[model samples]
Target: MLLITCPECGARPETEFVCGGETHITRPGPFAEVPADVWAGYLFHQANPRGKLRERWRHQAGCGLWFNLVRDTVTHEITSVYRMGDPKPEIA
Candidate 1:
C-alpha cells in the first residue's frame, strides 16, 4: 500500500487521506464576466501528466489538515510533502 505523510500528523496510511486533485489552479474570474467556455475549462480541465505531479491531499482520518505533495504517477513515489500555503518544492 502507498504511504502518505501528513504534515501535521506524520506518516499515515494512504486511506487516511483523500487526493484533492492538481494544485495551484486559479478561479477564472467574476462569474458573469467570464465566458462560459473559459469557466467550463477551468472547472473541467485537469492535467494528467505521466511523470511527477503536484497535488493536494486532505488527512481526513488524522489531523484533518490539507497539504500538498509532489509524487510520481508512474511509480507512486512521493517526493515531498508540505503544508498547503507553502510554496511547492523544487524536486530533482
Candidate 2:
C-alpha cells in the first residue's frame, strides 16, 4: 500500500488519488501543419521512468485539486508533492 501526500488534506492512501499522466505537454500550434508522425508521437509516446519522476495527479477523493508529484517509480514512494502553479521546493 502506498501513501500519497495530498497537498491540501495531508497524507492519505494512494487510492484517494488518480494518475493524470505527464504534466508538461504542449499541443502543436497549427494542427494542419503538424506532421502525422509528430502528432502520433505526441499522442502515443510516454516516458516510463524508473527513478524519481514528475507526474500530474488529482486528489479525486480529497480536496479535488490537480498537483505535481515527484515520486519514485520503483518503490512507489512519493518524494515531494506540490500544486501545479506553485514553485517546487529544493529537494535534498
TM values, all candidates: 0.93, 0.84
Mind giving the per-residue lDDT tens digits that candidate 1 earns over 1-92? 99999987888989999999999898877887999989878888888899899999999998899899999999999999888789888856
- The best candidate by lDDT is 1
Candidate 2 lDDT tens digits, 1-92: 88888878988888998999866678775998999999988888977777777789999998998999888788877878889987765534
Per-candidate local distance difference test: 0.90, 0.83
Where in model 2 is the C-alpha error above 4 Å? 88-92
Worst 10 residues of 2 by lDDT: 83-92
Off-target runs (Cα >4 Å) in candidate 1 are none
